[model samples]
Target: MERTLSVLAAYIQPSPYGAEGVSLNHGLHFTGGEPFLNVDLLLKGIELARKFGIPSLFVETNAFWCRDDDDTRSTMRQLKDAGLQGMLVSVNPFILETVPFERTFRAIQIGSEIFDQKLMVYQTDYFMQFSRLGITDRLPLQEYVSRVGLEEATSRIELLPIGRTAYTLGEWYQHYPATTFFRGTCRAELQRNYHNHWDNYGNILPGFCAGIALGNVLEQPRIYEEGLDLEVYPILRILLDTGVRGLCAYAQKRFGYQEREAGYISQCHLCLDIRTHIVRQAQEFRELRPVEFYTQLGRDVPADQD
Candidate 1:
């Protein structure tokens, strides 16, 4: 994990987006299932970013650990002293569905006091809306949608119709044939300099296309410098040349993958479903990484795994 961060820091150049809102284009931002879940690791990463001179360093969280005033204050102080520049607190209808609003409220309240202007509330608009709605604790997504109306609820969320979202929220979105989402090749998304992620498992997830790996940094440390060989990353090469439609075709012929009868919500939705099917089949594809993603999504697989 430390080596991956070091390698990434060397290649990650500062961009104009650095001055903008909390975009990953800026620099090393620790994110997670929840960064606060492992405080020691989070602190180590923050300190390492500082050591490597990585700019715009911060950590994102769902604020589930803001249990009390003392805990929040102590943790924030410890992180600040460890060289964390700021923090982003995530809030949305989906987060509210499970995480109590009081926890988020406490995070914002204490975060402002500690990090001051450096603290960012992602989608601060939603925070305001929840506050205005008198949401004090946990609220189901359906109930929130019902209270605010579907259109309004949809407008407030910064949702991407991929992963489990496409399946769980498909009812609220328009579905189209897989071909309809084949807007263009994925070369741009795969090669873009922004919003890339290198997980602890060493998989490089470009453009937040989780479950798909451009390559593993730990195994191919020179990937960023030498570039990926198309032959080595066949799945990535397919997406790079022909887009999701091509992937769908390839999966169909090679893995007997069938398109969902119900259709898809977005190009990413189709891509994720195809990749999930391929992972379930257990045919080795270097790009379909972190097989645990499929398991977490309720897909069955052979017992022994990564």
Candidate 2:
């Protein structure tokens, strides 16, 4: 954790793009499946970031563990005291399906009091809609949609057509054959500097592209010191040079991979499906680190299915 923060602290600088870089604010944000699950580790991370003078430190959570006022307040205060600048409570239908709405409401209510303007609700739209519904307990997403109307719900939600959503929510989207999205390369996405993530295992996830590891901070601490080399990452090179289509072709030839006849919702979906196949085949690709991501997704649903 310290090494990753150290490297990140030295790497990021004040944006020279001025107002254009507003969305690309350089900050260390702690997020996960849910950061609050391990309060001790979360506090330690905040302290380490502060020790390195990393500004705008914050944590994002689903508030699944915010069971009561006292525990919630204590944990929020503890994080603040440990150098957390802000908190974002996730308020969406998916989270509301598993975590009670009361917990999210409590988190936002208490977090606002604690962090003030720094307490951000990721999708205030859903929060407001859910609030209007007067739901206090956990509700299934289908129930929420049934009440709100599918079109209305779909229009309001910012559902990214990637990861598990590509499978679970595929019915709502138009599916295209793998070759349909072969127009562009992944150079821009792979080379993106802003909003990238370094996972717990020190694997650098460029452009929030999970499962794809640019390099490990622990193994190749200075991997990107001189910029990315295509030669070093042959798989990444194919992705950059020819996009998911190239990757599809390579995987098909090498691993006897097959594209879904049912098709994909987006290039990312296709890419994920292909990568998941590669991971399941036990093929070793250094760029495809954190194999558990694929395993977990596979456990959830078959990536190749629509």
**Local distance difference test values of all predictions, in order:** 0.82, 0.83
Judge candidate 2 at residue 164 and give its lDDT.
89
- Total backbone collisions for each predicted model: 0, 0
Residue pairs in collision within model 1:
none
> What's the TM-score of each model vs. the native?
0.92, 0.92
lDDT of 1 by residue, 229-299 (tens): 88987999899899997999998999888877777788888888888878777748888888877778754
By summed lDDT, which 10 consecutive residues of candidate 2 come out lowest? Answer: 15-24
Q: Tell me how far the alpha carbon of residue 304 in candidate 1 is from the true structure, in angstroms, after superposition.
A: 22
Q: In model 2, which runs have C-alpha deviations exceeding 4 angstroms?
A: 13-25, 303-306
Kindly provide the TM-score of model 1 when superposed on the true structure, using C-alpha atoms.
Answer: 0.92
lDDT of 2 at 119: 84
